[model samples]
Target: MDRIPILRMGNFLLVTIQVDLYDRLAQNLESDLVQMVSKTGARGVLIDISALSIVDSFMGRIIGNIGSVSKIMDAETVVVGMQPAVAITLIELGLELKGVHTALNVERGMQLLKEKILIEESEPDEE
Candidate 1:
């Protein structure tokens, strides 16, 4: 069982996937990530998949699940460093990842996360 490391940066959690993920591994990652977010109270999650050259529907769904869980926990999720081929494949496979945000790299993703957090913080809370 391979465990994906989740690094905490300020109010954000960074997940960098450097190897191809098997089904169980991906599933575990999703579960672990959601738990980490809840435990740490992170405001944002940055998933860097630059090293992944291949992704199937299951993997795509796991990513979507992570994003959804994060949002429900009041945190934003940003997927970064997606390979061009993987992006095309995901689209062709009909996995649009609707609720997940994307970025070209980690730096841009971090900036985006910060901006999003700021915008969210500025918004008035609903009674």
Candidate 2:
């Protein structure tokens, strides 16, 4: 069983997928990420999938599920470094990955995540 490294950078968790992911690995990642978010009280999640060239429906769903769960935990999820072909394939597969934010690269993703956290923090809570 392989575990994906989740690095904590301030209030964000950074996960860079350097190799292809199988179904079980992806499932474990989703579960581990959600747990990390809960335990660390992370403000956001940055997933860099630049190394992956292919994506299937299962993978897409796992990504979406991660984002959804993170949001429920009050953490934002940004998926960055998606290849053009993979994007197209996801679109063709009818998996738009709703509720998940995306960026061109890791740098941009981190910037967006930070900005989001700032904006969210500045907003007043509505009762």
Candidate 3:
């Protein structure tokens, strides 16, 4: 089983996918990422998929699952640097990827995360 490394960046978790994603690897990534969010109390997750030229439906679901789980953990998820082909594939596959934000690159992704965090922080708690 191949493991994709998850890096902790302050209040965010960074994952840069450098290798091709397989079913097992995708599953591992989803579980590992959600666990990491809980363990680290992260406020956001940034996934850079610029290297992947194509994404199958399974991979797309895993990505969506990661975002959904992160949100449940009170952390935002941002997917950045996705190639046009991959985006098209995901759309064609009808992968909505709810709760996921997107940016053009890592820098922009980080910025988006920060903005979201700040907005969340400034909002008054309902409780």
Alpha-carbon error at 106 in model 2, in Å?
0.5
**lDDT values, one for every candidate:** 0.92, 0.94, 0.91
Clash pairs, model 1 backbone: none
The RMSD of every model to the true structure, in order and in angstroms, is: 1.7, 1.6, 1.7
* lDDT (10s digit) by residue, model 1, range 17-127: 998999888989999999999999999999999999998888888999999989999999999999999999988998998778999999999999999998887787743
Scanning candidate 1 in windows of ten residues, the lowest lDDT window is 118-127
How high is each candidate's TM-score? 0.95, 0.95, 0.93
> Candidate 3, after superposition: displacement of residue 87 in Å?
1.7
Deviating ranges (above 4 Å) for candidate 2: 125-127
**Which candidate would rank higher by lDDT, 1 or 3?**
1
Which residue pairs in candidate 3 collide? none
What lDDT, from 0 to 1, does candidate 2 have? 0.94
Ranking by lDDT: 2, 1, 3
Residue runs of model 1 more than 4 Å from their true location after superposition: 125-127
Error of 1 at 127 (Å): 11
